[model samples]
Target: MRIAIVGGGISGLVAAYRLRTRLGADADIVVLDRAERLGGILYTGDVGGEPLDLGAEAFVGRRPEVPALLGELGLTDQLVTPAGRRPLVWAGGAAHPLPPRTLMGIPSDAETMRGLVDDDTLDRIAAEPDRALTWYPDGDQDVYSLVADRFGAQVAERSVDPLLGGVYAGSSRSIGVRAALPGLAAALDAGAPSLTHAVAAALPPPSDAPVFGGIRDGYRVLLDALADAAAARFVTATPATRLARASRGWVLDPLGLVDAVVLATPAPVTARLLRYVAPKAADAAAGIELSSSVVVALSLPQDTALPDNSGILVATGESLRAKAFTLSSRKWPHLAERETALVRASFGKFGDEAALSWSDADLIAAATEDLATVTGAVIDPVEAIVQRWPGGLAQYAVGHVDRIAEIESATAELDGIELAGAYLHGVGVPACVASGETAARRIAESLSAPAKS
Candidate 1:
């Protein structure tokens, strides 16, 4: 009845909680984490005498996982939405409204990209439908390649990179077409004549529902609830050194024998752990690269003359160190009540880990300077907090879908062993939650099945 869950991030926590529910109080579940605290990247820190998320502050509201989980936990009261302000893209040394009717910054028509890209690029976009397209049904390529070749490089770098950079902490050049924009990929695979037409087909239908949701007190509220409900033995500051098969089930290092084990860790760590048991899966995981990022939260005077927009996304080749700035006070109504305005400046991306080495003071200085540069506001911070996430995000590079398939197929026969993490299907909180719950359900079903005669 003993189960060992490795990695204490949201994925591992969700797995443990689901396991407790499926097996009841009698089942012994142990959650192990190398960090002193749980919740993985979903960390909430104190700033200006209040809670603020240092990692991911929000989730896609249209996705049912997060909102549904809150309801089940009776924490729906903590749910909150944005103030409905659109973000601006910082390009050509100025701010412009984010183009509408685009799929991840790929505009459906040339008119939408007006004022953002030059006349030549816009004209190219308008005439793209007449251009012949070559796409294989199952082939994949980087987003930059697809967009830059069809539209001009301006559309890929200025229009698309900002949005893709925010999502993957990587540029369009680093992200793949199929994994990041499946709908667009499908349209191309289905013989769309051009990129413009494919983008139009891929775009979701307009909806009144808010694009994102967040917890009022920060992600800590959700983390605390999951930990309490799981009621598992919490083992912190410990890593699972090795994993091997046992006579009856499996043997997880430090935790000893267990009926089941879930490796809800990052790709690199997961690869290292599965080296012997599932070498193919390990190799596949090892190929999945990671991206690092740093978040610097600054608290300023509430009356600071910042832009009314929710945030500012920096275009590629911008002269600033920050890739984006989330104006917390303007974006979230719950945070507007605070005496000081809140802003989050993000740094680093795939193949760029320089920010991780920056001192807290340096990061704060950069965030302040960059905020001033982007927002045209006075650069004075009442308080600041810096959090570094080394290899926090997994790059869904070209052929990522096939890599995931290889990993999953290789591990399908390993009974009592499961895998879950942000690297699997997606890097978002909702996807991680789904991955953990899936692993838990599989484990529960395997255990509940009758033994062979």
Candidate 2:
């Protein structure tokens, strides 16, 4: 049987690997990507003669998918965790400790937001539990609307927006409560008295495990390993233009007829691929917007006096051009051994695409300037590398859950087609890994079924 997996991102790569394992030696699988290289946004570039991830550098370790995948690939030795350091939030012209016991920066109580917000905002938060909250069951809205209305705009801007910006590359205004914070939404739907109570109920139980994980070298190691294991024909710098029903199965452009196909491209690309085969799914997917981002990696002198914290997140309305700074040398213990200290400054957001057009020199200059402002340290970079990811992240806007449900329902009727990507369920590495494997399993099962007489 022949299978085509479109898009060479992590989701598509993982799907190809899973399909290889399930189908064994005889099955033919081809992986196609429009880019010259694979890994999609998970690109690793060099800085100061050492490999550093220019895209996502870490994954949520609390999830099992990443660790489990590493073990399967015998690359568990590459799995590394953070140094157990807390990240600070830069707001009000200073850096403050990131609030504790909060779900994505929505504090369970007023005290968690004490230093970050003003006294008036603190008073508002303290009294929030007593206010009557109006939340309809199974309803949805932007996170900013809910947090700002219930706890004052300061909480949403200073505390919540920074964290959301780091995750979605978009503000709370572009993310929805139901999809971004399902537990909190469930708590509200279950009739929680106030936002405070809902946040309290939704918070996960505390644990000592590291909250995030990364590869010791870079994501390139995993990408290389997955590619080798999948053993599929890799087609780079080529895009699959069309997909349609065929006599026996399906015809994927450039790849010809295949027993099955998995479209692991981004939301917009996936929507286009499904336009004729599944119009409803395509409509829902087309409504899902994307956000762009840029990462500027700076190699600094090892003796630079950066903060002891893991990283710094910028609050909304900050004058700095950068949104966040990941002190790679401080965040990852494995990177501390490098010759020069490493820092990754992120730029752009959902509606802000200006950084994407900036020259590498300009991006590096902005990163250097912003790092100085946030860290209050001498800014001198030994070397720098800039990577741009336009329309890289999917915005989980209001009614996102309903849209995903609609997309899935409409595509479920197809016999030999599957969809997987960061847009459907989540934007994290673990979520993408799971999506790919799930898609592979479903397609393998359908193809393995006996034909009706």
Candidate 3:
């Protein structure tokens, strides 16, 4: 049997790798990528120049799936973590050391972060323990609303938004926190308990958390490792424009034929490709709103005194242009020399993609303004590399889960079609890996069912 996987992102690669590993030489698999690259958004630029991840910086230790995947991929020795002190949360006016016990600024106990705010502010928070979010999982609540309710408006607007903004390149109030941090939602559902207790229970044990980790050469190490293992036919720079069903199984127009297909591309692209063949899948794909973003990697002169040894996160309010700033060199010292700093400035989201069209000069100017606000830095970066990702990221809203359920139901009627990408589940690297593997399993099951019949 022949299996074809579409889109070359990490998800697709994982699907390909897992399928190969599982089926052995039984299945003839081929991965089709329109780009010459294999890692999709996982691209690691300046590989030899100075190792740093332009895409996913570190894998969250909280995710057991990540560690499991690492071992499965034989990347056990490549795990790398921050080399410095605990990370600092930049909020209000200064960088505050992360309190003893906090979950994304929502302290399990109000007293834990007492040093962060005055006693008066803490009093206001204590009066409201329910933190009952007017918003719920029903596409009605947003990141800011949920956090502000469970924590307080001050924490949400001042601190939480920026951290979330850094992740989604979006406004926290509008973002679907239930989608991004479902554990928080689960915590909220726990009755009478503080959001803190709920959070602790919903997530794996805290001790199991990895500070943060990636390959020494960056994420590319995994991508390179996967590519080396793929003995299947590889097709690059070729888009499977149309997927027409053939009696044998399926025919991918101009891109050759296949028995099964794994789509790991963006929603819009996937929607357009499947519109004619799988209208419901296409419609489900179309419902997903897209977001654009740009990451600016500025190489600073060594003399620059960064905010701290640990990286910095700009409260959404703190940065008008640059949503977040990370002192990459500080976060991963090996990425720079004694005299150089690999500082990353990020910009993007629904209303703020204008930064994408700006001339290189304008972008640098705007980013510089953010640099000044977040850090007291006055020196100009000696070199800058700007990367713009147009319509790449997926946005999940309330009712998103339900909508996906409907889409899945509609697509299930088909025998051999499979969908995989960030659109369905969590949008992180490890999560995407899980999605792709799930898709492959679905396809494998569907292909076998006919024989049983």
Candidate 4:
């Protein structure tokens, strides 16, 4: 049996790795990627002689998949938690501490969010418990609509937008609630009277375990380990442009016939690749929106005083062009050991493409300027590295859940074909890994089934 996995991102890599472990020695596996390098968005760059992640840096440790995978790769010891987990929000020309006991910016206790929201908004939030319960919408809805409806526009803009933007790199007003914040959606559907109370009820009891985990060096370490484990024929700089049905199974153009195929590319690319064979799935995949972003990593002088918080989430309507900033040195103790300070400034979102048009030098200048403004300290950077990810994040818009279901149902009719990636389910590293592994298992089962007799 031969299996061809398209795209060498975490999803593809994980899928290939799973196939290798589950299949027999007779099975042949190959991973095809368009880019020259593997790991896709999990890029780690060097700055001031220390490794820093340019793309996705951490995974939620609460998920068992990543930690289990790490153990399998002998990377359990390399897991490191953030030194400071609290992130501040830069709004109203100042950095305000993020309210505690909130789930993705949805405050559990209105009283705890005193300074975060204005007096009018605070009053509105405080009155939420007494407000009449509205029936949950039957269909999918955007996060901002649900949040703003319950908490008012101010809380939606100041709290929810920054947190959701930090995750999706898209507007909460546009991203779907069911796809992006499923727990909150479930709570709402259960007839929860208040958003705050619903979110509070959904959250698990506070524990000592760290919310997120990262590798000692970088996420690249995990990618390298996956590549090593898979030990498959890697075809870099060669993307599977077309996928079609063959006499026996599936055919990935230029890669020839394979018993199974795992499409691990982004939604847009996947749509194009699957168009000829599965038009319904392709069309549904094409409907999914994406957002672009740029991460500018700056190496500052050793003496540069940075915020003690993990990072600052730039609330919507802030004067700063950068959406957020991570005090890399402060957040990761491994980087703090280096002689210089490392900061990563994020720019661009769904509708914000102005920063993408700027040159590297211009982007650095703008990021640095925003850094100074938010940090309230004038500091010059010694070195800078800019990384642009066009269509970096998949925006789960309204009806995304239904669209994914339709795509899955369509793909189910096609033999020996499966889809997996960040676009399908959650966008985190763990979710991607789970999706890929699940796809691989499904393909393996289909391939091994007894002639369907």
lDDT scores in order: 0.94, 0.94, 0.72, 0.88
lDDT of 1 by residue, 1-453 (tens): 999999999999999999999999999999999999999988999998899999999999888999998999999999999999999999999999999899999999999999999999999999999999999887999999999999989999999999988889999999999999999989988889898888888888999999999999999999999999999999999999999999898988998999999999999999999999999999999999999999999999888999999999999988989999999999999999999999999999897779899999999999999889888889799999999999889999999999999999999999999999999999999999999999999999999999757
Candidate 3, 1-453: lDDT as tens digits: 888888888888888887787777789888888888787777687823766678767776666666687687788877766775565666767877656555555656667657666676576566555544343324446666655665667667555665666656666665675677777776665552555556566655547344566677778888877766766778899887888778767887666777888878888878887888789778887988877878887878787877665666666455457766777877775665535777777778766688778777777777777777667878588777777777767777765676678778877766778888877887677788889889877877776676533
lDDT of 4 by residue, 87-158 (tens): 899888888998888777877767767888888888888888888867555777887887788778877788
**Model 4 CA RMSD to the hidden true structure, in angstroms:** 1.3
Q: What is the lDDT of residue 226 in candidate 4?
A: 95
Provide the lDDT at 31 for model 2.
98
Comparing 1 and 4 by TM-score, which wins?
A: 1
Estimate, for each residue in 1-453, the C-alpha lDDT of model 2 and write its tens digit.
999999999999999999999999889999999999999999989887788999999999999998899899999999999999999999999999999999999999889988899899999999999999999986899999999999999999999999999889999999999999999999999999999999989999999989999998899999999999999999999999999998788999988999999999999999999999999999999999999999999999999999999999999988999999999999999899999999999999999879999999999999999999999999899999889999999999999999999999999989889999999899999999999999999999999999756
Clashing pairs in 4: none
CA error at residue 322 for candidate 2, angstroms: 0.3
How many residue pairs collide in each prediction?
0, 0, 5, 0
